[model samples]
Target: MALQIISVVLFTVFFSEALTLMCYNCNTTTECTQANCSSSCSSMTNHNGNNITFVKKCADSAWCFNSSINLGLIWMSSQCCSSNLCNNATVSENGLSCYTCNDKDCTNRLKCKGGEDHCITATGESLQNTVKGCASKNICDNITLLNNTLPQQHLSSSCCRGNLCNNAQKMTQGPVLLLVPILSLLFYILGLF
Candidate 1:
């Protein structure tokens, strides 16, 4: 009986692994078809000025989260789920907002969408090459995952949870502000002698 129970458990596990989740697959703004995935389903929305595009397909679970990316000229947002046929064309605004960077300007206002609750500031090798936008908390916790969604890699990121909190000036001035009290204390100690 014990041997039979072990065999049944193994069979159940194998059967579950064989079952795949179905997702809606589409690239254009046209009709979508069914696609099978072993992990998760994904829906991605790309916004460029007045134009908006949508893409739906199967994705890996490791990439399953709502995240937004801004690469200067273009901004893309993706939402992922682990249920069958869960990749729908509903990318709603989450009421949070942040700033997006462009080659000419870094003050473009971006409305957070899907599960984006945090503002992200991602910088490349040089501080000059920076991208700021809205992101989900999952992406904030694992900033390296942004490389998968971006055209470029080697980006370090910082996340904040407030309106337009990714402003560059605040981040640059933070270190200088910290030195103020320390410098004052040192001068006071020198004068005491």
Candidate 2:
């Protein structure tokens, strides 16, 4: 009877420990994937099928750019301005562009040239800002001023704790060990009753 009780307790403990380890692995894996996803998306560039150009001077003291594209319906053009003076700017062929200005004077202005398509305009103010202009057949889309920001640092502390992978592994082991003893105690009491 004692042998049977010990075996049952060991089995229950082992099973619970295994389950706890699995849960921890799954949760941490998901967290790691999300962190990676956020990292990747933060660095995403333009998509494709767009042309952007940089303009040195504008009516305002802010930096500006003119983006033009032929999207099969009409030729569209957009002028985007940085809130302040030019600091950093990026233009890409993938229809994604961004500019950063120094202050709040950054304003983005867009216009659809030709075809009587009724000009569209949008504006923004920022310490540093960017703008995206998009055009498609039958529709003219202009993201006058858009902001491209760097990702916030959140994982520094976690990473600083020795190796992140090793820490995660150690954390995962805790839950497994915790569940094992709890399950063993529960099983032992049940067997006693």
Candidate 3:
């Protein structure tokens, strides 16, 4: 009986589907749908003075800082969380910080989003300019060769730990703002109905 009970427990633990997380999956100005996954992510991108927010279900739990690529002039930052409908709540940007440079000089700074713990520097992607920003440790470790390569160009990248360690000529960190309490209050008020 003891062996039978142990087998049942092990089977349940290994085959449980309760670990799946519900996330809001949507792109810029698109319809939001529900998805089940291991992680939820909120990505914010800024391009040409415009900001767009995206939410999605993710397999990996990680985030990124102000990263720019040769595709366009933009910055992408993502926040990941693990809770039921947690992506609907505010994600804290209290992670690492890094400098982001697209085509212009590396003067702007981007705050690291959730789970982004490493700073990355990449250059030579046909554009022949350097881009520095924060990235998740997983991406840095598993995506070295392609760091400087994409479908259209060749690229090279290096990763490092430490805040603002991307080695920008002028190191500047983005402003850290807290909005948890306010969002909570807003939700509480709405729930009063």
TM-score against native, each model? 0.56, 0.16, 0.52
What is the C-alpha local distance difference test score of each model? Answer: 0.64, 0.24, 0.51
In model 2, pairs of residues that clash are: 47-94, 48-94, 82-106, 83-105, 83-106, 99-129, 99-130, 130-146
Q: What is the clash tally of candidate 3?
A: 3
Top-lDDT candidate index: 1
Candidate 3: residue 30 lDDT (0-100) = 82
Best model number under TM-score? 1
Q: Write the per-residue lDDT of candidate 1 for residues 46-67, one digit (tens) a residue.
A: 6555677778888877645566
How large is the C-alpha RMSD of every model relative to the true structure? 14.2, 28.1, 12.6
lDDT of 2 by residue, 1-193 (tens): 9999999999998976544311001121132121111001111111122432221222321222233332111223333333332212343343222221112222222232322222221122211222122232122222211111111211010001111111111111111111222222322332210
| lDDT, candidate 3, 1-193, per-residue tens | 9999999999898776677677777666788787777655443433333544454444365432222221123433344557766555544575667876634557567787655678776554354456676666544664543532253545556788887777766323221111112212222332210
Deviating ranges (above 4 Å) for candidate 2: 1-54, 60-67, 71-77, 93-193
Q: For model 3, what is the error of residue 98's alpha carbon versus the real structure, in angstroms, after optimal superposition? A: 2.0
In order of listing, the candidates' clash counts read 0, 8, 3
Q: What is the lDDT of candidate 3?
A: 0.51
TM-score of 2: 0.16
